[model samples]
Target: MNADQVLQTIKDEKISFIDFWFVDIFGELHNVGMPSYAIDKNSFVNGLEKLDASSIVGFKSVNNSDMILMPDPTSFKILPSDYDPGNRKNARIFCDLYDGSTDESSRYNRDSRGIAYKASKKLKEFGFTHTNWGPEIEFFVFDTINVYPSPYAATHSYGGSGYSIESKESPWAKGNVSTAIDIKEGYYPSQPKDTLEGFRKDVCDDLYNYFGIRIEAEHHEVATSGQCEINLEYDEMIQMADHVIGVKNLVKVKAKRKNKVATFMPKPIFGDNASAMHTHQSLWNGKSNVMYDKDDEQAQMSQTGRYYIGGILSHASALCAISNPTTNSYKRLVPGFEAPVNVCWGLGNRSAAIRVPMYNRNQEKSKRLEYRVPDPTANIYLLEAALLLAGLDGIKNKIDPGDPIEENVYKLSPEKKREYKIGSLPVSLKGALDSLSSDSKFLEDVFTKDFLDVYSELKYKEYVAFAQTPTAWEVSMYADA
Candidate 1:
């Protein structure tokens, strides 16, 4: 859709509000809405203008804060009536940020969406037309959540600061313990045990009807406390990232409407399976799948695909800083939780960071690698860009990925691991950040030096805060000593 078409649709659909939306560097959605009467073709072409970039995290500082939001008509959509009060028609369009500080506006260097666009364009330079990404989004829903202050804070007349969550599916839930799902056994139970079935269906329906995001499947995940997974149909990189944003927001909104709280935090519950966004990816040339080689006997993976895996494995530590940005994200990446902790590739091995699905062998389009390390806490745009750049670097250098490990990586002896040359992902956010700081040249194509500096600074602050804060477990371990 063009600017004119967007305006015509607004008039024809009687849309009262047009929401101009853009993502910040942290992948949080920001918007400014205007009445339909105030919208025109110029509004789309020239943008609504004058966003305070200083206020947004990882954006410009106060000295150089001005920015513009150029709405992409191709991303226009009329939101469901439930989105507004009184059923007033409201529409939304995703925007690209532009520098408003100068007379001639240009794409903002720190804008994540613009970075995604640049990353997509970078594919053409590598002789590939495009790439597709499918992210298996996992999250948890809770009935209620409560937080309390610390003992020191209570003594000082300050509020408490610890949290507790509840879910009917949890063993700790009052009266529901009898019917609660066993730990790590919530996969595909029928109606009575699967409390979120209706909820998932409703969310999926809205995703398709309102946002045009196709749902491949939705079901209970292998965790006791309301864990769920929703699979979306694969699409081009940028579009897929956009779909991720929409799906996350919709899930949260729908959960709130039903008096439940939804969280995508990687390790919300200890001693349970952690949520992860296992991204399935493939490179394409026009209509051809460049990742498939039917003649290959072992995995049927093409040379291009093997090189891509090599790139990801070589840079897995650095990539973790972006893909698992949060402090809680590290908690999820630990062993025994089904999260990939080793830097290796394997066919049909969940423990390996990159798993080439064996189920779709010889099926040209379906032959792709699943990167199993990222979580929903990541900024999808940045994560996708970094992954693509690293893979391209691998291809350019023809990096050898070594052999595919078939055995469980977590079960491998220390000596065996050393012999296989398998390395582990960073054990903490600080470690991951340090790795990224040392080895980030591969990301220079799309991630600028200035952007990296700002991003690193912001993420380091998060790491420091988490490191300093004492948790309940720490108190329990040391109070008697």
Candidate 2:
């Protein structure tokens, strides 16, 4: 939408509040609202809104904290207000952050969305028109949660499983625990078992209606305790990142309205499947799909696609720092949870880090690689940018991705893995950070050194903080040792 269209929509819809949205370094949305009367073409173009950078994590020091928000007119939308109940309505617009003091109003170096824009521009320079991304974001919805945690103590308790279910409709209330879906076996079950169907539908509806996200599919994931997934249609890189934040927020808010809790945490449960955001990506030059080849001997992917996979595998370790991005994220990356730890591409193999999905045959548009390392915890802007850079590097260097492993990677013997040249993703946050520190030349082209350093320091501090803590398992296993 143009500025004039935005104003006309506000006027026609009687929108009272216009919320300006932007992301911090971690992809968390921050917003400031103004009365609709305050918005005009001049204010929208000149970028009058100011934000305190020091208040945002990994942004700025108190000495140099001022930043400006310039709302992108194209991102203007009418959002359903949570607080307003009268005829007055609400709307939202995604903003790009700029240096308030700069004469040119240069983009903030730490703005993840801006970084994605820069990355996309770099892709065009490398002969690729654009990079497209589709992410399958999985999350868990719980009926209730209770927790207590501090330096002196930590304990958590929740109820959703058959053992502690309090719902009167639950068979467990009538002494039929067998009615509960078993752990790690909740994929595509019907109604009573999939209690979140209505909720997930509502979430998807809101995402489509208000946020402009086109959801392709929604269903129960491979975890018994309220795990679900909603697959959104593919979009351009920066737009996809914005949609991810929108979908997550919509899901959480809709779940809360039903007195439930939604979590994108990689490993909220100990022994079951953990949530993951498997990102499918492809490169294109206008309407033509550069990643597809009908006559390729190995999988219909083109030479460009192979090189892109090669780049991802070559930098798999470093990519984890941004793709996984959390201390708890490592827990989900471990074996036995269907985690894609093996650094190899495969056709329809879930265990491989890169999976070439076998869906929609004869459709060149659907030919793409799904990088399986990322979780919902990642900053989408940075993660997508890094992925695109890796692919671009591969195209530039003509990196060979090696053989596609057809067998299940998890079942491959150690000797077989060695023979196939398969390597593992980083096992911990510290390991991933170390890998990024050593092999981040690709990212340096886009991310400022200071910004990367700040990001690394923040993540490393989290790792150290978690390492310093003693867990309940430690007390149970080593108290006597």
Candidate 3:
């Protein structure tokens, strides 16, 4: 859409307010609202509108803080809600941040949206035209939640009391016998066991109507209580990143309207499956999928594909610093959970960080790699940019991803893994940061050192806080000692 089209949209939809939304380094969405009457289509589209960057993490300091927001006309969408009915409708647009004060106004390196866009542009230098991405986002819905933390004590609890199988309305409620889904068994259960189907659909409907993002599938994930997964059709990295943030927003909004809470926390629940945003990626060179070659015996994967996987494996440890940024993210990466913890590539092996999805030779377009290491907590822009850069580095340097491992990597002994040159993913936020501190050259150009320093410092503080915090387990283990 152009400037004129956006004006028409505001006029036609009776949008009273427009929210310019952008993502911080922490993947949190920040918005600046403007009355519809105040929008100057030409000026806004040209990047005249400014925002205070001092308060936004990973941006400039207070002394040098004004950032410009160039509203991407293509990202115009209606904010789905009944809060303000009829003519009082609200709309949203994704913006790209830039250093507006400079004579040569350039995109801020910390502007995650700009970073991803710049990273995507690098594909042309490598002879690839575009990178297509599909992310399978998993989340949980809780009927009630309370997270209270203090300097001395902390407690976070969440569960569905009324929606349990023992509820009076549930089918299992009558026998007084427990019919609740066993831990890690929540995949594809019917209405009684899976109560969030309608909720997921409502969110999907809004995504489709509001942003034209197509949903490939929506169903209960492998967690007993309210865990769900929503699959979106693949698109380029920048657009897909926007869709990811948009999906999260719409899902939470829909969940809240139904008096439930939705969270993308990697490990919100203990001893059950954790949520992950497994991304499927394929490199395209114009009309052909560059990652596929039917003549190749190895899952019909091209030489380029192998090298890309090699790059991803080589940089897996460092990439985790951005891909799985949270301290809680490491909890989900441990063994016993379905999330990938090994730095290896294999066909149909979910335990490996990179998996070459198994498909028929006839289905060349389906031949792509699924990066399973990332969780939804990651900043989508940075995550996509980091992945692309690593893969591109591999292609340029001809990194050799060793033979595919068919065995379950989680079950492999340490000695066995070493023999195969397989390595474990960083087990903690601190570990990932340490890996990033040394091996971040692959991410250097796209993710500038200035931004990375801020990112690392912020993440280190998170790790320190978590490391020092006393938990119930600590009290239980050594109360008297």
Per-model clash counts, in order, read: 4, 0, 0
lDDT for each candidate structure: 0.88, 0.85, 0.84
What are the per-residue Cα lDDT tens digits for candidate 1 across 1-481?
A: 8999988999998999988878888898888999999988777667776599889988877997877888889888888765776789998888888885322237888889889888888888889999999999999999987767663552455643468888999988878845599888998988788999999999999889988999999999999888999999999988898899989988888888889999999888879898999999999999899999999999998898999889999999999999999998988998898999999999999989999999865699898999999999999999999999999989999988998999999999999999999999999999999999999999876788899888999999988877877666776788699
> Where is model 2 more than 4 Å wrong at Cα?
81-88, 101-105, 149-151, 154-179
Order of candidates by lDDT, top first?
1, 2, 3
Query: Could you give candidate 2's per-residue lDDT for residues 1-481 as a string of tens digits?
Result: 8999999999998889998989888888888989999899886777865789899999999998888888888888887554345656789889888896333439888999888988888976777788789999999887765553344453334211121323322333454354466778788988777888888888887788888899999999988778899999999988899899888877787777678878898887768889999999999998888999989866888988999899988999999999999999999998898998789999888889999988666678888999999999999999999999898889889999997899989999999999999998889999999999999998897987888999999999999988987776776778799
Clashes of 1: 4
Off by over 4 Å in 3: 45-48, 82-87, 101-105, 149-151, 154-179
Highest TM-score model number: 1
Error of 3 at 21 (Å): 0.5
Q: TM-score for candidate 2, please give it.
A: 0.94
Arrange candidates by TM-score, descending: 1, 2, 3
The window of 10 residues in a row where model 2 has the poorest summed lDDT is: 159-168
Candidate closer to the true structure by TM-score (higher is better), 1 or 2: 1
Better of 2 and 3 by lDDT: 2
Please list the residue runs of candidate 1 whose C-alpha ends up more than 4 Å from where it truly belongs after superposition. Answer: 101-105, 150-161
Residue pairs that clash (backbone atoms under 3 angstroms), model 1: 148-160, 148-161, 149-160, 149-161
What TM-score, over all chains together, does every model reach? 0.97, 0.94, 0.93
